[model samples]
Target chain A: MENSVDTLLPTLDDGIKCSAITSTDGLVLAHTGSGATLDEDFLGAMGAALFAFGSKSIANLVGGKMKDIVVEGEQGFVKVTILNDKLLMVTVAEPLKLES
Target chain B: MQQATTSISAVQIAHNIEKRRLFIEKPQSQAHVTNMKDAPIYKTRPAVLQRAQNQDRTPLLKGEPVKEVKIILAGNVGSGKSTAIRAISEIPVIGSDAKAIERNALHNKESTTVSIEYGMAYLDNSNLHIYSTPGQRRFDFMADVLCKGAHGMVVMIDNGCRDPLNEMDYYLHQHGRFLQNYPGIIAITHFDDNNTDTSLLDYSTYLLKHGLACPVVSLDARNTLEIKQVLMNLLLQIGDFKTGKKRA
Candidate 1:
């Protein structure tokens, strides 16, 4: 199943440097792209933590479901989207560099 | 719990409002109330959710405001996990109770935690979400689910129970990693009835010997003042952790 996820990442936009599927427990199941300089393990753990925090905070405060979370850093951006009850998809990418 | 009352009427804060001294030891609270005309306006109740809605949402990545803190209560049957919550919770605790079964029936007062218990307290506009884990081991699965992302925990130990030191050991062993990841304290319940060969020092000694430094305190779970002390201690420890102070 992870192999299937790995096969779908190259089709993303050029700025989409890294994409991976991670379990809710912080385990990286599959990966593609390389815009991220940090280790995949660290990236996966971070994705899990961010998702968990976002989901729980929203659940308790807003009392609503969390659809997705986007974290932007000076270096790059990390996007986490829920894929299923037990898995989330994280995309690490650079800014699109506006056509200005 | 040892103090389980069939009718919570006796423990109801609305009825005991006059009786609540509101902990003179509780800093800022006395002054805050006195400056507000000395009339207690906010009757500790469920409708008052201590949540701060005015958080700066500067995009998703910069930072997220801490609207509340989650704390878990872990202990065995009759450790007063239920009563402590009732005594201190500003809101009516939301949970079910059932008649005790098996060896638990011998523990005196009936009823077991049917599910997670929730209570809340407001501190500096941030909500303190208190959650109680069921005492039965069969409910371990539920404990895992309830404990995730909790900022800290207060592990209650019925010191009068058989070999309470071992009980403390068991709980810490079960959650040592979790506590290490977060701040936690040891609350000795049933201290008045404690007839054991050990004292508070013994518990502290043992924790120190085992390389654990979680603060230990004697508290009557039925007394709101003592419960607040325990909560305040844990809160301070969490603050200390944030500021790089040595763990208490």
Candidate 2:
């Protein structure tokens, strides 16, 4: 299962800094990163927590399961997506630097 | 983005409406402050008692062969949330405890719950699934996740802490929405560890002043009998909430 995150890494663009695949129970299965010093455990736990609550909230309010959650901050973005019922993927990426 | 905010705002509006309804319509029960130990659990509500007797107390999962009741145990680090579950659970607890990266330590404990802990106990006719959240504020998202569809909340506070009242206030505010709809109980731990001046009545009074008519009791989380008492009280409180009967 950890290979799932590694397999997806090659397909992502250059802006991606790190990525992790975590169980729904918040355990990190696999991770791959190059640009940032990522804490895989913390990332996995936070991602699972966010996805669980986000999915529930969306289901209650919008009448459907949430596919993903994208949180934008001043420094970067954290995106969490539900890969399946039992797993979720989290990615931390830098903003696209527009060549001005 | 506008649509998302609107949907969230609608939920907030509905929550506020429910709060207002309870506060205005149930003034006698909502405003009353009585000693929980002395008060009868269901003095006036026979329907709730009958329902419990029939094993129809609110189930976490509906249409299941076995009735599952979800309860969330929450508190600060070293407040004994995990220990309480261990004491009461019939099976081995599934814990996500890990070493703390931060230097700050409470109760000289090095490791803490990183995500969630789970335990299970079978009561007369119901299977109780107990879930505990990590105590750190950074892991608060786990608490929010566990709060969904929960039957009740047990907030264990360490009495020996420097500012137990402040900790109580923080937990109450953090789970205010859940408390508003479901029953909540404050279980004070570590009372013997320190001779704190704050009495149990003070906790009850604080809760009443803050518009929460929840029970406050002291117990050693490691003691199975004491933990059972707390859960029994919580079940009674859940019954009270369901029947709209306020504890007198």
- Candidate 1, residue B95: CA error in Å? 0.8
Output the lDDT of residue A19, model 2.
82
lDDT of 1 by residue, B71-117 (tens): 99998768999999998788988764544434443267566664577
Q: Write the per-residue lDDT of candidate 1 for residues A2-98, one digit (tens) a residue.
A: 6687875544677877787876545577877644475666566566657666776688779988999998888788899888866778898887688
Off by over 4 Å in 2: A1-13, A17-91, A94-100, B1-66, B243-248
- The window of 10 residues in a row where model 1 chain A has the poorest summed lDDT is A34-43
**Model 1 misplaced regions, further than 4 Å:** A1-100, B1-67, B103-106, B243-248
Estimate how well candidate 1 is docked, as a DockQ score: 0.02
Candidate 2 similarity to native, TM-score = 0.58
User: What are the DockQ scores of the candidates, in order?
Assistant: 0.02, 0.07
lDDT of each: 0.67, 0.70
All candidates' chain B TM-scores are 0.70, 0.71
Candidate 2 lDDT tens digits, B46-117? 333343344334454666465567899999878999889988898888765554444355576766676678
Task: Give the Cα error of residue B163 in candidate 1, in Å.
Answer: 1.0
- B6 Cα displacement, candidate 1 (Å): 42
Candidate 1 residue B153 C-alpha distance from true site, Å: 0.5
User: Per-prediction TM-score, please?
Assistant: 0.52, 0.58
